[model samples]
Target: MNKSTLALAVAVGVLAQQAGAAGFIEDSKASVSSRTMYFNNDNRDGGADQKETAEGLKFDYLSGFTQGTVGFGIDAQALVGIHLDGGKGHHPYPSSFFPSDSDGSAASEWSRASANVKARFSKTEAHLGGALQPNMPILVANDSRLLPQTFEGGTISSKEIDNVTFNVGQLEHAAGRASSNSTGLAVAGGTEESNQFRYAGADWKVTKDLTLQYYHANLKDYYKQDFLGLVHVWPIGTNQSFKTDLRYFDSSSDGKNGDAGYQFNNNGGFAKTPGEVDNKTWSAMFTYTLGGNAFLLGHQRVNDDGGFVYLNQGSVVNDNRRSEEAGGASFYLFTDSMINGFVRAGENTTFGQYSYDFAALGVPGLKASAAYLYGDNIKAKNGTSPDQSEWERDLRVDYTIQQGVLKGFGTTLRHGTYRGSDTGIASQDQTRLIFNYTYSFL
Candidate 1:
């Protein structure tokens, strides 16, 4: 049966049983969220332009566990996207805003639903089926588009240790944020599908101001990766603090990653071994916050072996349908900019941002920020220029209703401009506006 029908069936069955159960109905919660987004991108270097406006409706339900030593519960989600506007060539092939139709146009509307069964013990929990979004350093499910990308997987999380938390799981497939169907996982370049993605990680709260993290992940026949992270926040005074964050990633080829069908594409950048995967990346960010002002400075460096890699399922296209989805990626790095990810081999990037909160001046729920990033010293596989460089600037403003009937309403505006050399990715100026609201229902 379809996901929607299945979700309805599950909801009805659980509610029917809850009439006689103790905790099922008493602890249940449901909510609906709505989002309207407008996107416009102009490629100054004669590249294709993108413009689209869409609306998204999301429903979420969380059921309380039944009384038992190992209580059982369920969670359900439904997502729908309405294609408000995308005229003709605005949303070209492989668009990220919405799913494409059979005739290469934006689909009128699309939807999907999910449900997960979960069990809870003293300090641990297990979840199976439906949606899995692990926000670890190695893998992050993208939620930047109309609908969030979701994975089909089983996960186990435990907080048995006093100051440590653990997460482990295996994902089989993923559904893109714009598509209604799921597909196997694979990085950029290779077309061969890998059905297994296993990961494990832990976070240790070393002290009141410091935390340490470690994670590892492996995609069958693709690549294996390990990550290490450290974060510390030092309070300076009233409403003042200094924060430091350091992250490192080490990745290499796995089973068949060096083979013909499972090779990586190095994100269309330089790969020392053509399709083979081999890279190391590290970044550091320091921030200072005082009163209503915050400033951040960071630097990132990509090793010379190859470009940093991550999962990008854009290669698995299938007739403008299910496959070739899942393109938006959010890596744990400062270089993940709006126009480009400065992850090319042997590249070094320096970036900074400054933000302010209007609440310090009596107006609450309003904020603005601006950031700049400059990258240089990039290397190419074909022995091109060694000093290739690029830069980007972004500005953002956001506000939410602090009181009144529209207390939950939110709006955000963002704009960015990027310029790069011929050896780098195309340059562009992009703008985005979003409005969001949420309401609880029981």
Candidate 2:
């Protein structure tokens, strides 16, 4: 049966159950989960180098559905982070994304929380209110925190058709996980109002092994973009498989980000031009797997007179996708890099990565990956030549037990090395580790 039919059946079952119950309480569900993490980082040389140790706690709570043809629900979260230690002031890349105290220390502690109300009907869902997070490559929030970042806005998702999912949203503001205030978003290298973001998208499953996705977004007066993606996964044999993911992006200036042939008003860092800006980028990655081992290869190229990449000034796209389709998303980590290891802004760059999974080796859940990125001969139209070379190496290993005393508990280790000159800034080596566990009581 098709997925839509399946959902219809489920909905009917739920409604039938609701009709026979003491309201919707018989079908209601609620739960609270906590996540704790210990983090440490060390950066060498440069005033931007980082050396820090910290701890974080996050609480996730959900309230079951309420009565009506449109069911109502609520979800709330709270996050608290504490500074365990910071060395020589610059550790934690102090000068980059975070502001340091006169003493060069990170936030002694920081916290943020949000709540959202959701309504569901048939195969559609809508949400509104304080919880801030709506992701798009052109407007992703920086959540490298032990706690996830959020945005304030309104969004709707619909799955009324058998093979399609549609989404639309309007984001009015954002609240950084470490900060409580709502801030407008702007592109990294432009001067304009970055608030009032908007987006829409569709996902269609064409076949059991193929899926197609399309998305369009605008960051207020900053930039407008469209994304086209195709993905396929096929099994080669009992123990072998192959998968491919390809994407294309087209970008142009919007409102203030667009030059009106007028001068002196900076739209972020982008300069006013006789005409608006246009950028195009395409990338594809494929992988083949056998047993517990896998090999991947991918390449991405950007063509534009200027830095063709667009990133939210305060958020970063370091090595993953801006969309939260899954727990671990895809990123143009190599397309453009994150400033301070998280922000992105640059031009003329090409990159690739390789990874492996250990689940087939009786490890239940374990995986590792390593990546290398390089940017060279960066030239811009009205901008100076960043005639320099920058490269980075990233490594990660994670494992989670399947069935044991510590089932569901997991640990991850990550490390990175970066070196560069010119254009936007400095260089360094960094490391991060997170270990945590989750439990459910419903």
The prediction achieving the highest TM-score against the true structure is 1
In angstroms, how far off is 411's CA in candidate 2?
1.2
lDDT of 2: 0.58
> Model 1, poorest ten-residue lDDT window?
317-326
lDDT of 1: 0.84
lDDT of 1 by residue, 311-356 (tens): 7776664454336555566677878877688898888999999999
* lDDT for position 316 in model 1: 60
Q: Which stretches of candidate 2 lie over 4 Å from their true place?
A: 1-45, 88-104, 135-141, 189-193, 258-277, 309-350, 380-387, 421-424
TM-score of each: 0.94, 0.79
lDDT for position 391 in model 2: 71
Per residue, candidate 2 scores C-alpha lDDT tens digits across 21-103 of: 34345544444334444444443443544555666666665655667687866656777767666656444422322334446
